[model samples]
Target: MNYRIILALGAFVPAAAIAQDQPAETRDKTSAVISVGVDYEEGSYGTDQDIRSWSVPATVKVQHDRLTFAASVPWRWIEAEGKGTIVTPDGPLGLPLFPSETQVDQRIVREGLGDVTLAAAYALPVKVVNLSVSGTVKLPTADEGLGTGETDYAVGADISKTIGAGITPFAGLTYTMPGSSEGYERKDGVAVNAGVAAQIGKRATGFVAYQDSASTSDGLPDGQRVATGVNVGLGGGVSLGAYGSAGLSAGAPDLATGLRLGFLIP
Candidate 1:
């Protein structure tokens, strides 16, 4: 109970980083946004058994001057032959590892809130590339069935350059340090992303990204994924987005898809 309160409070902390790639001149514009989305993913995680999960998330973001603050949390439902919930922004990464065993396998059907993620991004002014630095904290607010119930921290930097033909190329690197857990001997990990975005139509944009993440613990394979998304703007502060992704390696999900709806206050 006490830890739950701490997790809720920690979510509002401005310690996490988010990427803000807007023009430097428009960084000072004050704005607020609310978004909601649902995602579903299925994978074997190098095991014979399959794990399927659904995540419904709500997010709020506010920008003041050049800094943006955001918080997001998800309600997750998982079905698998597993004992661990272990939810993260990247989704669950196989079952937990016990001190005695590298990984545990058991029947699991769980549903609840996973964790709360807090972030803040500070945009750096540059004429050529838009650069931003930020960090992230995942607060464990859910029970063992939904989360690891341990706090996690990460920091990252993003750089992007927009060139001719409304195309932008971007790259980012993030380092994550998982919190201590009883059975799970979590480890520090790094993830890298490279992507290119282009305008597809007057109101639509498309992007393709490749992501790779090091293993975070024993028995979990490294993650390699390819993802794509399309976003379209509707007049009057409304936007819609859709995404699809596939895993290229063992630890990543086999397939995932999601849709997002956003409203902006200017």
Candidate 2:
């Protein structure tokens, strides 16, 4: 083996060992939390080109007496080119007097409400287990011709079960209701998502998750999409998280990515 490889491995060993030396009970906690986060992401708004944006998301959560309630609001400011037609490919093509370059220049600045979520969870008096029902409403905040704002809603349930070694596995189900759009009739669909998070070191936790939503619109094909993300706790109820995912099927477009720095308040 190369000497450089040995040196790199030597440097990484201590960090890994320190991460694994955390106590189990130190990571186990049940507390009500309210968090605010900011993210910077560069991706396609509704097309193939890259669009960069800064987002603000604030979440409030409470878990007590075997019940949980939470809400999240996200606001975004986007900057890019060639993202005009939104989820549809017709707006640019439909204009007889409009040129492609003209549409690209005017479509750069786009802003609106991203996704709002509300959730309710109940612990069944069982050890290390809980069940939750959540609903997300996508308001018509983003412009239709320049963004994806047809207004949709989703209802889902989440199950979290704890096993050995401080690992919890979670699964979720969602039903989607389509929005109003010409030539794009509403079609209902389902989504399934699963994830796991584990304690790392004395003050950190890490996680990965995947989710697939059914095709609810004829405008796009029906298929599966997978997304994975990671989070690291920075102690004092503060954490840094980052996630990026690409489409597993044709229905997915413009590999989505995001990073968040969050502060939790008790």
Candidate 3:
């Protein structure tokens, strides 16, 4: 070997070995997503006349590896001239009592901030099937006209199977334990949802789902609903989703529609 080349090689090899002995710290892999949307629902909700409801909701979700956390709240407007109780998308929160024989001239609309909800979920990394478990808490933050003014809790599990080309079948089940209200003691309820989602092209996807929930109180029937929706990617980490639903039973809304816009942050 040439003398100068050997000297250069000797110096370089020790530096390379020293560099291999130390490793840089790994970065934290946490991400967040925010979403806002408006929803409208109409039905009797087991009342004498059709009641229309609307809500504007905002949510923040965070994820780190397989764990996820989220918080959501909504501003609600309810046409409650004939509504007795309201079971929101956040689950049952209100059990308002109105005299059935009250004069129609005395009716008034109810509007305010609805209940605030928090949730956490964890997924297990597995092949063939994906599985996750979650828990949720509902805080009483609304006036008595809009909510039961009580806290509630739920635990749930979700399972999904992914097939070829972005088609997946999924199902979830939740059990809720509700708090009591004056003259109307609530009971635990069970909810289940199943669906198939298909990826259409690169920027859009579609899904159809069925949902059902057991009644949490007397005089209220079981809720059944079917829905279809589409989600489209708008580039730059933004997306939009729209959905429509129909009630399969009297316990659910006769018709409902909603849209959500979401942004992903790294």
Better of 1 and 2 by lDDT: 1
TM-score of each: 0.85, 0.65, 0.83
Q: Model 3 segments beyond 4 Å from truth?
A: 1-28, 83-106
Which 10-residue window of candidate 1 scores lowest in summed lDDT?
1-10
Q: Write the per-residue lDDT of candidate 1 for residues 12-116, one digit (tens) a residue.
A: 112243555554567668888788888888887665557787878788888877687888888878777644443333432223221112256666677878678
Model 2 / residue 130 / CA error / Å = 3.5
- For 1-266, candidate 3 gives per-residue lDDT tens digits of 00110110110000001000001131136767788888888777564665677888787877776667777778988775443333332334344444344545344477888878787777665555667677777788876577777888877777677678778776777787878766667898888877787878888877777878777777778778887877778999897877888889888888888887879898
Give per-candidate clash totals. Answer: 4, 0, 0
For this target, which candidate reaches the highest TM-score against the unseen true structure?
Answer: 1
Query: Ranking under lDDT, best-scoring first?
Result: 1, 3, 2
lDDT of each: 0.66, 0.46, 0.64
State the displacement of the C-alpha of residue 48, model 1, in Å, after optimal TM-score superposition. 3.9
Lowest summed lDDT across 10 adjacent residues in model 3 is found at 13-22
Residue 160 of model 3, lDDT score: 70
Which candidate leads the pack in lDDT?
A: 1
lDDT of 2 at 159: 61
